[model samples]
Target chain A: GAGVSQSPSNKVTEKGKDVELRCDPISGHTALYWYRQSLGQGLEFLIYFQGNSAPDKSGLPSDRFSAERTGGSVSTLTIQRTQQEDSAVYLCASSSDYLSTDTQYFGPGTRLTVL
Target chain B: AQTVTQSQPEMSVQEAETVTLSCTYDTSENNYYLFWYKQPPSRQMILVIRQEAYKQQNATENRFSVNFQKAAKSFSLKISDSQLGDTAMYFCASSSGTYKYIFGTGTRLKVLA
Candidate 1:
């Protein structure tokens, strides 16, 4: 089976610009997750969507960060007015369900560089 | 709030030897799941092993095993007969019914030949 996939493997933008990263979860996956990993730092939870339930946006660092999952299959993370601090590797993951025991399959990640 | 901690920043073990990575987490949920993930230089995160909070028996996957101390809120991963390919960053995580996971900072392991 194909693993999670992220588009635009690398993106470079200037400060104040907006960028959208895309993620395609495995077929039939009902849960999706987004995380940010800064240089030498741990993964920072961004957001998640589960089936038809409301998405969890509590992990969004600021209002400038937002995400949307369409048809429960694909997800897009958008950063408005990006800052230099926004530069990092953005990773997406998905699982069969939201159960605690389900393994989350990760994507190769999109590295965003904000100058 | 749930929090995972990995005190060791880095560690090294000779090939064919044994190594153990320590992880501790604090969570209020009584039923949850703990996991160990390995991220290689390629930046791919792979699941190594998992342990359920309600299970008393530890989880093991071949050479990879876990010492899960529920009462102490500790979950440590042990790798025996370490191989060069085992070198990577290891992250410990915990998740409950909320479906939100808390991850540790990670421990970088280097397998020496």
Candidate 2:
């Protein structure tokens, strides 16, 4: 794809329900990132994937938040037992490689509304 | 740990005017990168400009430029000849030697007609 792609642009789920968001990064990109944005707040780092290394999950707020990238192309963010506070936009980004100066391209975020 | 901060919550500028957005970050790493991203109603994050901490000269892209102060931990975005299309939420971010990014609370810029 020419740009990063995300699915389920908008989702309204009941509290305690689980939701899965998908992201497809640009071809040949070796680094991927996930972020969460609450209403009127800045983007919060969630996780990072660099090549075949173990993902950097230091930013995950809780055990309910988890993500996986398959074949180094597509990624999934799963929120278990979603809470009302989980209502936010989930963003995904990809970079050519995991370098300090690498520029990241972002996808249209998925807006999750936990009702 | 790294943290970015945007002091201004909202700003307005007339078409053809110039506006500056403020940002500051804290990090102990010496090798790092700074970035400014724009997000319109479409929700796509677009890179506006970037600065390398090691470079003393600022980075500029046409009408967009940045004033990066490494010692003060400040990075600001200046938009010259602002246009109505420039109305959007602007974010400041930083990345250390690692690939993870830390973003600041955005500034909502409204370019008035």
lDDT values for all models: 0.94, 0.95
- Residue A17 displacement in candidate 1 (angstroms): 1.6
Q: Across residues A30-104, which tens digit of lDDT does each residue of candidate 2 receive?
A: 999999999999998899999899999998999999999999889999999999999999999999999868999
Candidate 1, residues A1-109, lDDT tens digits: the string is 8999998899999999999999999999999999999888889999989999999898899999999999999999999999999999999999999887788989989
Tell the DockQ for candidate 1: 0.67
Runs off by more than 4 Å, candidate 2: none
lDDT of 1: 0.94
Candidate 1 C-alpha lDDT tens digits along B1-113: 79999999999999999999999999998899999999998887889999989999999999999999998999999999999999999999998877777899999999999
* Residue B112 Cα positional deviation in candidate 1, in Å, after optimal superposition: 1.4
Model 1 chain A — which ten-residue stretch has the worst lDDT?
A: A99-108
Query: Best-fitting candidate, measured by lDDT?
Result: 2
DockQ of 2: 0.86
